[model samples]
Target: MQSKNQLVELPLFAEKQVTLVLKREDLLHPFISGNKYRKLKYNLLEANNSGHGTILTFGGAFSNHIEATSFAAKEKGFKSIGIIRGEELVDSWHKNTTLLKAHEDGMKFKFVSRDDYRRKEDSDFLADLTKEFGEFYLVPEGGTNTLAIKGCEEIITEDDKQFNFICSSVGTGGTVSGLINSSFPHQEVLGFSSLKGDFLKKDIDKLTNNIRWNLISDYHFGGYAKISQELIHFINEFKKYTNIPLDPIYTGKMMFGLFDMVRRDTFAKGTKVLAIHTGGLQGIAGMNSVLKKKKLPLLDI
Candidate 1:
């Protein structure tokens, strides 16, 4: 039941004399949407082909990847294990809607300290996990893998070629890599990083030969999972104006960056811009809780 999400033009962009359309990839699924869906599409198939009954992945407290993977595995009839970072969450993790929803979806969580979580890619660590959780298909954190990039390659279609710039929010670089691979030579792919770092450039370069893409490293307000009142206000205002609910973690930041670029006249007057709305809307409630704790404006989802 996968349908094409609409590409709606933003009136704000019209004011700037620029054509900006949001590819509503968020409409793909209530749970699994946008890049999460793209990333997991082939990974799950590979897991099933490998004869594994369970899928084990890693993520943090409010990871959209964890939430999406949990629901996706449930929908696809695969048992899921989320190796969650921050061992302290073991006691009252239910306070977070993301983890609670995953738990409800039958995703067992293995809580570990932040330091221990860093060893996720180590062979010995993975071997120990296989012994502890039994033989399972391991998906890297954020669901970025070779299969993931393959799935993401499908995000663009023949219809998207009209746009000169293809933009997406980058997490683990899989989505941008896919976009880069599929982009036409006449088009440029721009990735706005949600995390603060230049580290993703090498990771993205490893996946594609297309030099038509560039990473925008300055948009991350603070760092990963870190938010400010300015970002919260922008998310709220954006929802009110466009009725497009953007998750603060990914799409919100991406949109904020896109709007900033538009305001600065980053692109030519007649340029067409397509911003991919990579879904993470499910995490809004959890984010709202944190915002409420900090006495900040919550996303008007």
Candidate 2:
């Protein structure tokens, strides 16, 4: 399903004379929304065509991938198994909103320690999972695989050709890689990573040889799944003004970076920028719970 692109209006836009539009990929589904839908679409078909009866993937407490994969697997008539990263969550997984939603959608969980989770790519670990789950199609953590990139490529269409720049929040690099591959020659693709470091550039390079893309390494705001009071305030204020809700992990950081760049005149005057709102809104409730426990201000969505 193609989502409508809404133009974002801000005082800064007029003052800077730059046009900003938000590609509402978040509206793709109430549950399996945004880049998650794009990433999983073809992967699901591939799994079914390959005669797989179960889908196995990896994630953490509030991983959007795990939740989206669960619903997608159920809708496709395939069973799903989520290899959760934290072993301590095994007892309380049902209490966590994200995991609970996945469970409600018929996902089974295999909780592992953080140390053990790091070995997910090892042959022996994967072999053990295959033996236990009985021959399942494996989706890598964060849902970035060859098939996933193929699906994400469809996010940008001919209609998006008018824009000079295409921006998105980079996680596993699949969505941004797809954007890079599909971008027009005149359009530059900028990916704002939601994690710390410049390592994602190498992974995206492995996927596509395109030289039209650049990775922005300074906007992570810590690392994956890490949030701050400032980010929470920005997200809330942004929603209040634009009616567009941004999750703390990805889109929020992306928009923050994009706007900051605009203030610094990163783009020339009259430049049209299209920012992809890859959805992770489902995890907001789970994140709010964490904030509540820590006595931090909750997201005002």
Which is the leading candidate under TM-score? Answer: 2
Tens-digit lDDT track of model 2 for 174-240: 9999999999999999999998988999999999989998999988989988899988998999999
Runs in model 2 with CA error above 4 Å? Answer: none
**CA lDDT of every candidate:** 0.88, 0.94
**Residue clash pairs of candidate 2:** none
Give candidate 1 misplaced runs (Cα > 4 Å). 1-11
lDDT of 1 by residue, 1-301 (tens): 2436454456667888888788888889889988899899999999889898999999988889999999999999999999999989999999888899999999999999988999999999999999998999988999998999998889888888889999998999999999999988799999999898799999999999999988997789888878888898888887776678888888888888988998898988888888888898888888888888888777776
Which candidate has the top score in lDDT?
Answer: 2
State how far residue 297 of model 1 sits from its true place (Å): 1.4
Q: List the residue pairs that clash in candidate 1.
A: none
- Local distance difference test, candidate 2: 0.94
